[model samples]
Target: MKKERCDAASGVESIELDATVVATIRFKAVPPQLLEVDIALCDAAAAGQVDMYNSTPLFVAATGGCTGAVDTLLKHGAEISCSVLYETCHYGQAEAVAILLDHGAKVFANTGQQNPMCAAARPGSVKILELLHECGFDINPSDQGMISTPLHEASEIGYVAVVEWLLTHGANVDATDGAGKTSLHHAVNRRHSDVVTSLLDHGAQADIQDTVRSYRASRGKYDIVQLLLANVSNTQRNLTVTS
Candidate 1:
């Protein structure tokens, strides 16, 4: 009897059920009716299967952005926490995230291996970002350790809206990551001209160099290099006049 594996990407595991049975319970394919039946038959059947990395029914449903499935699972006593929230944020499932939050899920749930705010930043959904903020997600949390703030992620990915929102909400424009690279450094490295411009407008320090390498020397994005240099020169001139 070969042990059946749940979706490897989901990191779920199941008992040695038949492959067909496992297939019927997949996150994408399982209808609400079938999910109810499966859960009733084996509430502890790992929902999709218990993997080292994946949680149960809630995590699986959230990952798929199946809001209906998530509702059903939550009603069935699925623990709402960071794991589920992180998955929904990663998939950009705003509706699922809303439902979870309505059901008393913690916005700052201990993100096991995922950062919920950081994940939200990548997709540039202002609504979700605002919702997380309303629920007490720090706009500039340093808990990410070496990963830096949501602003850094947004800037690196060229999410101008998210970057703007973070700045408006008090995210430190010059916060550095474990690599000592600020959001400006990331925006400059990626050559996201619009993001670089927005960061500068929001008071990001253009002259701050990263510990690993110089932004001006590493990439030859002439426009971006010129923009950074121009900002630095303007600031220096202002200081000289003030002195």
Candidate 2:
């Protein structure tokens, strides 16, 4: 029986649970010794200490650890976790991601509820998205950020392919952000016609309005009147029109 770490305990409190209970929190914070030792490994790799990332658990040949020290870690047998790799990959580090995958990092490692697939869409990296998919990532994971899915992130950022991939992968097309504004709401507010169209094609609510009045005012260009007319249900539309 193993217990996942919790913030409630002041110190290291261990619990015993069956594998299912332990399954969710797989990647606990590594020990300080490992972090320090891994730094040396990363430094060595950065200096070309390793030929390629190829080791189980990837502590060896991981060129990416702590972002800045990626190249260094690869030399000493340090494979980066999937989330960090995807994040850097989103920033266009194709070689870095390739190395991590080569070294046997799990593409499905959902890092703290933020999946690598979400990271790929955040930066609008089509290459990163493709690579992660090729490696078998869940394109439409339910994990979200502040009430937003990866599709919402891509739509908000005007990432066309990201939005497309998410829709194709079965992302909830009408998914709302923390603000309760749907993807279409974000696109229209941001004036991204392409994103707006993409979202609409996938059945995003056209008339979803910002519950926050201030947010609506912030987007002076958005026509709250027209949006309400087009997207609301006939019953609601009639009521609003009559009122």
Candidate 3:
């Protein structure tokens, strides 16, 4: 009987299932093809050196965007712990994310990356973000880490499309992260002109609307603040001209 990896003796994490099997799973292999890797869907951690994820075959499948393999693993009770969903979102595997969600995966994963929303934002996965919203994820989850919301993450990386989508879906345009910086602040600091424009379209960007907050900028580049004030001036001028 081919036992699942979870059946291994208590707390053993080193690769139980062969790395080759995991590699196969990572490269888009599905069902019957997955037959050789143990039907039990092991919980073995195939550390980075070997499988590059230090996670289970399920996680490997998720990161690889192998939807069928992920479904197979979930059917066998593979653990969808924090890391699993987080890694899946980080990789922008929407189909796999849907599978995990259907399998009772948590909407807001609290992995090393904090929220899966941030992970998806890093890659500009708007489809995955939509899936997250459908599953009831908070559009503006408070940044318990580097970014306050997915919008901040998108703007920080200059994911212009993602920034626009997040705004349309109710993310606070002026929301701040732990650094007390809004999406506009991040966009301005990162020189993401397109993202700056997107944020301006949403609402007030703290460009000069009485925001008592800190700035995440180098002392040498305090000029970025001036640039923001200058942008606000341009916007006001445009608005006046249009009126």
Best by TM-score: 1
TM-score ranking from best candidate downward? 1, 3, 2
| Alpha-carbon TM-score of each model against the true structure | 0.75, 0.59, 0.69
Better of 1 and 2 by TM-score: 1
Q: Could you give candidate 1's per-residue lDDT for residues 1-243 as a string of tens digits?
A: 234456455566544423444444553465666555554433333444554444565676677676776776677566776767865886788988888888886645544445577878878777888878878777776535347788988988899999999999999988878777888888877888889889999888765534113444436677775677677756554553354
**Top model number, lDDT:** 1
How well does model 1 score by local distance difference test? 0.69
Question: Against the unseen true structure, what C-alpha lDDT does each candidate score?
Answer: 0.69, 0.55, 0.67
The Cα error of candidate 3 at residue 138, in Å, is 0.4
Could you give candidate 3's per-residue lDDT for residues 118-155 as a string of tens digits? Answer: 77898899988888778777777764555578888898
1 or 2, which is superior by lDDT?
A: 1
lDDT of 1 at 243: 43
Of the candidates numbered 2 and 3, which has the greater lDDT value? 3
The local distance difference test score of model 2 is 0.55
Lowest-lDDT window of 10 residues in candidate 1?
Answer: 209-218
